[model samples]
Target: MKRFQKAAGQWLPKMAKLRGVTAAVVASVALSGCGVVNHMVYKTTGDVLQGFSRNHTVPYLLNTDDLAMGCAMSEATTPLLMSFGRVTNEPDQIAVMLYLSAAGCADEQAREHELTGLAALGDMDGDAAEDAMIRQKRAHALAAKRYFRSWQHHNAYYGEPGTGECPDFDDDLDEFIYMAGLLSGLQALNAEIQSTSAIGVPKNVGSMVGRATSCLDNEKWWGAPMALRATIWAMIPGAMPEGENAFERLEMSDRQGEQAGVRLSHVFHAISAMNKGDNERLRDVIRRHAESIEETPSNEDWAFVDAMSTQLIVAISDRMWVENNGHRTPLGQLGTFWDDEQEDVETMDLDDLL
Candidate 1:
């Protein structure tokens, strides 16, 4: 009896401890993985459900705005999509970051293009415009390369937003937004090639930009796609069809944004002026943006994305301001200079510390 009691006493506490630890671990996983599991289940089930509803119910219901959301859901959902992409490496999922990054490349090009344009527009005594134009051309060349990098990814992973039978608004918004950025990238490339023909760069974008239009329903979509079509008509070297004026279309897009109470058209205008290196126009547009927001701050319903964009363009002005005055943008800069804030100290000799 004593021997039996000793064995039970020895094992009972250890068994209880093991049970307690296992329960805690299970609780932690269940709390964290609830979201993960729910997303997988919903996505899997949604795709299965899409098979049945492809012909009738899906198209009419989903077409009001992209993805049938009143506000931008992509801002919130993109992180989740990115995490899933990293784990699965699925083509479509992986394409999300690739496409967005492509947009980022175009954004970068706009900044550099502005700088080159500034150089080009300067009145110099000897070969000033010519020198600046060459640099501008090179700038575009690099922008084109980034655009090409994006295009390669698109060709590999971008699925058409719709099938022959129905529009896939779910995936279409993601794909087409990337396409919008691509069109700008292509136009930037075409311009650079024109400027630097002596370098034997290919000046061919009409076909590529024209071909892109087929995949996107530009008639139904505005903003970036409309800007793209306008660019196609104006810059693609007689690529415009009969009776289509690119400038009119561009103005019409601007008007559309005005009527809609959101001047997304400003971003396009800024990009164009930057390509031309016309600082006056860029500054004017930036001022208009600041004033517009002040006038109707509440109207811009998608606060995060639109605000983030304004911050990016404002950075350009900050860059100029810093160069001329040796100070940063007013109200601090985002992802820019911090050297001023850091304390300057003499480095210790190795012997002093070691």
Candidate 2:
């Protein structure tokens, strides 16, 4: 009986160890299964978000004419949308638009601050002007950073600009995104210059984007590609091609844009004119934009793009008005200047009627 008891005790301890080993294996599998389930859930969710954003949200935003609403959406949702990058491939195309729109908001704020500084200087309030200038710089710096972020995403998706062959775009939307990316790079450089401090925007971005515009068909894109290249040529010393006149090309591009009802090329023309201190040319460009939008109506498929052009043109007009008149362009007077000649109107003769 003692021998039997000894054998039974040894068997019982072995069984206990065996049970513990089985329990550990089961627990490990359960934990591993949870991890697999989590990865699948996250990946699925990311895919859905990415698909919806690219297919639906982007198209809806592009169709609308409300820049303020678009800007708000960009600012509010960028973080949430971008966070999905942790679980899946980053939605670099959407990132380009989000950052670009957000940058526009910053750029607008910077322009307002610049006007405020100008007004303060006009008042001879040196301290106030300096303060406004500081604020302007900060806003410009923010704009530069956001624009650079967009450029980075652009590079990720389309390959580095000025590098090897252009991307094989899947559709018109892909091509449009490429153009926006180019614009983002150029804007980043401009905003960095305006900030007056090195905001890490590469100086070579101008020349790079200038070359990158060649990848796009200028006519298919409503002349915007050439306008962008021409603007860079005008802005950057020696960037223009041999025998090419930047302003002339800009004028040609302007015609194409006006006819297409996109009118984005006018923004580049105005930028070039403003940069060169050619107020006459700037005014002409703005006036043309005003008349074109009034007569042509924005392209139905790209109304948002047309509206953006108008917004930037009006901002430029406001800057000019504020500089001279200490106020923004008056309502319904975007194309008219304070000093412009008033048109003669036929008046009824009261004495003759009497």
Candidate 3:
């Protein structure tokens, strides 16, 4: 609690200076409004404040691909940012939800960097390898932390199944932000669990995530909501209900995202395939991504997000190449296999290594 207070104190000054307002002042305003009206206002304000966090924080952090920046941005924005949710009077629930969702998204990149770094450390010195391992463990740990935190908040806003404390969004932005949080959080949680050293993945996580964000309309969220649902379906055994088609839903999301011009749903499918250890499916998705890039060269909105997603896919390709042949993916390997037409490059394999 003391630590929380101290950290909150530091940001309070900046919050006042930049926004010319303080959460304490907002907290004092509860005396003047009806309970319901005040609750909506608080949640709406918190929802708006998170945009500033996403805008001012995410681009710079993604460009440099820095882990510290991801954590720093989380700390820097969350305190004063939570105040918006606080003022809204939803038991500080929305504030908690906003903070975790944004932080979890930021941490997703951190986890990916660690995964790639582990692969990149191949053939390094003992000391350097140990250091890389240390960093990777910590990175996964942070990723797990943010994801679980988001999970807790999701439960808070909407209680466990059959016990209804449902979330009602204020607008499109509100719903999008909420679902984005769930998407990132669930993905992060999966990565953390795979790391086997991640802290705090829920034991009942499968059930928790299976039914999460059920309120999201597919077309409304540009297929992201379904993409997330498909991910949980594909990754968790028996999680998909009888007669439900996970792949079809994933493909549906892919089409919707492509039509929406966001294309993030593909990333979800690719990541899911990777998790399931279906190399053929992974390759298929990667090929599709490359072909898509070939067809539509530029992504005007979410350029960096889409680029980073591709980078991770490339990192996966790099892993395959490293394990198969002694290097990262060949420069021309994506969308096309290296062994197909590139005669100069030997079609190396296990036989060559053995």
- What's each prediction's TM-score? 0.46, 0.93, 0.64
Q: By the lDDT metric, which is better: model 2 or model 3?
A: 2
Task: Estimate, for each residue in 235-305, the C-alpha lDDT of model 3 and write its tens digit.
Answer: 77888889998888888888776665556678778878887888788788878777776666434435544
- Candidate 2 segments exceeding 4 Å error: 10-14, 344-354
Output the TM-score of candidate 2.
0.93
Q: lDDT per residue, candidate 1, 129-229, as tens digits?
A: 55544565655555555454445444445443222322244565454445644554464455455445343323454455555655665434435467666
* C-alpha lDDT of residue 248 in model 3: 84
Task: Identify the leading candidate in terms of lDDT.
Answer: 2
User: Per-residue lDDT of 1-354 in model 2, one digit per residue for the tens?
Assistant: 999999999999999999999999999999999999998899889889988998899889989999999999999999989988988999899999999999999998998899999999889899999999999999999999999999999999999998789889998888999999999999998899889978888889998998899999999888999999999999888898899999999999999999999999999999999889998999999999988988898888888999999999999998888889888999988899989998998999899977
Ordering by TM-score: 2, 3, 1
Which stretches of candidate 3 lie above 4 Å from their native place? Answer: 1-76, 79-130, 157-166, 297-308, 325-333, 343-354
Candidate 2, residue 298: Cα displacement in angstroms equals 0.3
Q: Count the backbone clashes (under 3 Å) in each candidate.
A: 1, 0, 1
Global lDDT of each candidate:
0.52, 0.93, 0.63
Among the numbered candidates, top TM-score falls to 2
